[model samples]
Target chain A: MRTAFIKSLMSLAERDPRVWLLTGDLGYSVLEPFAARFPERYMNMGVAEQNMAGTAAGLALSGKKVFTYSIANFAVTRCLEQIRNDICYHNADVTIVATGGGLTYGTQGYTHHGIEDIGFTRLLPNISVVVPADGYEVDLAMGSISGRSGPSYLRLARGGEPVIHTKPIDQSLFGRALMIRPASDVAILSTGSILGEAVAAADRLTAEGIKTGVYSVPVIQPFDAETVAALARQCSLLVSVEEHVTQGGLGSAVAEVLSGLDNPHARLERAGVVHGISPNAGSHAYLRQLHKLDANSLVERIRKISNLSAKRSVKIK
Target chain B: MTAATQTSTSLARRIRSHALRMTHAAKASHIGSCFSMADILAVLYGGVLRFDPSRPDWPERDRFIQSKGHAAAILYAALAETGFFPADWLSTYSCDGSRLGGHVTGHGVPGIELSSGSLGHGLSVACGMSLALRADKKASRVFTLLSDGECDEGSIWEAALFAGHHRLDNLVAIIDYNKIQSFGSVANVLDLEPFADKWRAAKWSVVEIDGHNHDALHKNIGHMPLEAGKPSVIIAHTIKGKGVSFMEGQLAWHYKSANDEQLAQALTEING
Candidate 1:
């Protein structure tokens, strides 16, 4: 995903003279290609996130399209006020790229985790919050990012994530969710890099003679509300899946959409990290299992919400 | 002194007088702040800043941001008196439905660059402005005026370091070092005594001047990029409450609005 994002960024810079990239000194090997190609456009803004954000806003204010890069919270939360006042208040043209969304850096402890980034960034006005599912979506998002006139937040996991989309993604589908599978009245709406678990959950339900709607929503902030509302009408229950807190992530956004609907039978269930910080730390897989955010967890949560008696936990296979 | 320099001095007096009346009417604070930077503002808006008041958004115009934005009355006065708007607009300052609020905002107000009130934000934003201008090969410069007390914020140091690190020679910072702050003296609250040294450490070409001296203010501010490849910072040491006799060096003036008698006396002192 990092490779694809950098390649896309290089191409965007190559095509447009207005494109400029600033980093908080976190991009080591990942950003070399662009830095080597366009040394003038690429800047390593030390480790000062606030300064980086302010400079990005300044650049954007001067008619340059800026992309500020850093790992996780450093990119978004560390300099949130700069993003809020300097960038968003002026409505400057800058894209904030946050690598390591969610628990991609699990072994580095919870502090390195970007669990609350999307939730925090989602509250700011005039900025788009995007969480791409894979490398293909990352490439597509990079292409669309330059065309976005206002500030935007691009959420990505650390490099080497699996590719979920098997084919080319159209530009029109950039801000909208995609349905990869068609099965039942129950819909599993997943966001971020956790779409793999959702896809597997849909398959689990399909084998059990239950049709499930699997949608991968990459753009989380300005979500496809009309489509979600349209999907809400067909499904008995809508389950929001994310690798973030249930309060303000994809789940809360989907719940907000569900709340505005007048459908009598529509029910919304959110599956995300609801507990306090994880007491046990290991790998991403270990953490996901401990928090019950894996595939089986989604299948169980979906069944519980849809009035279907979920099979015994051990006998799921 | 030349005619323009004499005009700048007189303009400074008018700014102080106007600020006194506005602060008295609106019952707003920061009158002390407004008075301290009056001469510096007069010099900049008088003729030093490369600008046309009618063309507030001109690309080539040198950008000036009032980072210590609580002093909106003086900024508005400087703009209005210079014909950015009608001088009549000064009467509506800080009033309900008025474009001129107590804290400076720029969306509707002409001649203002960025809407600002928060300390330590303006310099970095100005640095950004300078960085972009240099990148575009535009000769336009970015100037920011901050407060001594506002330097207590960590972000100010961050911005200073950033401007220095980037070699933002197109950028300039003027600190309104009035020796006084909100709660107490700047020394008592947060000692920035080695302030020039600190700026020098950040790689800025530092200049110390009496902020109230019109000739000194004009001479220092009119110039650009004091040295090659370095941002310039002018530490204009000033009095908190300037112009008015009773208000000078008085901390009470920081928050106090003038009574009728005081306003009369203040205006009398300013006119003289």
Candidate 2:
């Protein structure tokens, strides 16, 4: 995903002279292509994320499209005010690229976790929160983010995540959800790199005779409410999945929408990391399993929710 | 003093007068913050900046960012006095639905490059503008005004280091060293005693001056790039609530809005 981001950004920079990249000294091997190609437009802003974000806003305000890069929380939480006031309030053309979203850096401990980034960024006005699920989605999201004039937060996982879309994905699906499977009894709406786990979970659920659907929501803000609502009406249970915390990420967004809908059919189940920082450290797979975000865990959680909802319906009858 | 210097001095007086009235009318604070940097705004808008009132978005115009954004009253006054907007607009400052927010904002106000009230955000942005202008090879300069109290923010030094390292020669930072902060004196709160040394160590060319002196302001700021291949910082020593006798050097004025009686007294001293 990191490789995809730099490649897409490099192409955008090449096409538009206004595009510039500023890093908080996090991108080492991944960003060299951009730095080597656009030396004048690229700057390693040292270890200061606040200065980097402020500088990105300054550059954007000066008619330059700016993107500031750093690992996970450093790109969002560290310079949040700068992003809020300097970038978003001013409506500067700045894209904040936060790599290592969620447990991708689990081995590095909780300090490196980006589980709460979407929660903070989605609340800010005049900014788009885009959590792309794979390398293909990153390319598609870049096209949408760069074409817009306002601020955007591009939350990406670290490199080597497989592209889930075997078919050609349309650029128009950038702000909307792309359905991987048709809805039946239950639907799973996933975002970010966790989409792979969601797809795997859907396949297992389908084989178990409990038909399931999977939708990849790349853009969290300006959320695809229409599709989510339609799916809610079709599926008896709608489960929202993300690598981020349940409070302000994909689940919270879906919950906020569903709660407001008149006569919403389906019951929503939020699946993600529970609130509060974790003390345990392990690999990405280990942490995902611990948080019940792994494919098998997700399948188990969904089956339990479906059965409970089925029992409740039978009681109503 | 030259004609320009005299005009700047008068401009500074007008800024102080307007600030006193605006703050009093809106029942707002930061009058002390406004008065301290009145001369800096006056001199910049008076002559140093190359901007046309009609063309606020002129591509080649120099950019001015008020990093110490609480001083909005004075900055708006400076813009109004220089014809960026009608001087009558000064009366609406900080009022409900007024464009003149308590903190300096560029939302509807012309001549403001960036909105700021939070400390330590301006210089880094100024560095960005400077870099952008340099990249475009445009000669337009970027000037940002910061307060001594505001310098207590760590982001200030982060930007200071960035500007110096990048050799953003087109950028100039003018620190309004009024010596007072929200809680107490900057010294009593958090000392920036070796302030000038800090900028010098960051690879910037440093100049210390009296912030309220128009001649010194024009002499230093009117010239560009105090040194080749380096950003310049002017540590302008100033008095809080300057031009008003009672309020000057009084920390109470930082949060105290002038009453009807105090406003009259302040106006008399300012005009006198």
Candidate number with greatest TM-score: 2
Candidate 1: TM of chain A?
0.94
Across A53-126, the per-residue lDDT of candidate 1 in tens digits comes to 88888788788999999988899888888888888878889999999888888888777788888888889888
Model 2, residue A216: displacement in angstroms? 0.5
Give model 2's share of reference contacts. Answer: 0.84
Writing each residue's lDDT as its tens digit, candidate 2 over A1-317 gives 88888888988998999999999998889999999999999999999999999999999999999999999899999999999999999999999999999999989988899999999999998999999888888888888987889999999999777689886568888788888998888899999998889999999999998899999999999899999988877778888998888899999999887877777478888989975545567899988888899999999998887787666751111
Candidate 2 chain A: minimum summed lDDT over ten consecutive residues — where? A308-317
Per-residue lDDT over B96-135 for candidate 2, one digit per residue giving the tens place of the 0 to 100 score: 8999999998898988899998888998899899999999
What CAPRI class is candidate 1? Answer: medium
Candidate 1 has a DockQ of 0.73
Model 1, which residues run further than 4 Å from truth? Answer: A263-265, A307-317
Q: Backbone clashes per model, in order?
A: 4, 0
Where does candidate 2 clash, by residue pair?
A: none
lDDT (CA) for every model shown? 0.85, 0.90
Q: RMSD, model 2, all Cα superposed?
A: 1.4
Compared with the true structure, model 1 gives a TM-score of 0.95
Expressed as tens digits, the lDDT of each residue in B18-116 for candidate 1 is 888999999888898899999899998887888888898889999998999899999999998988999998999889999998988886899988888
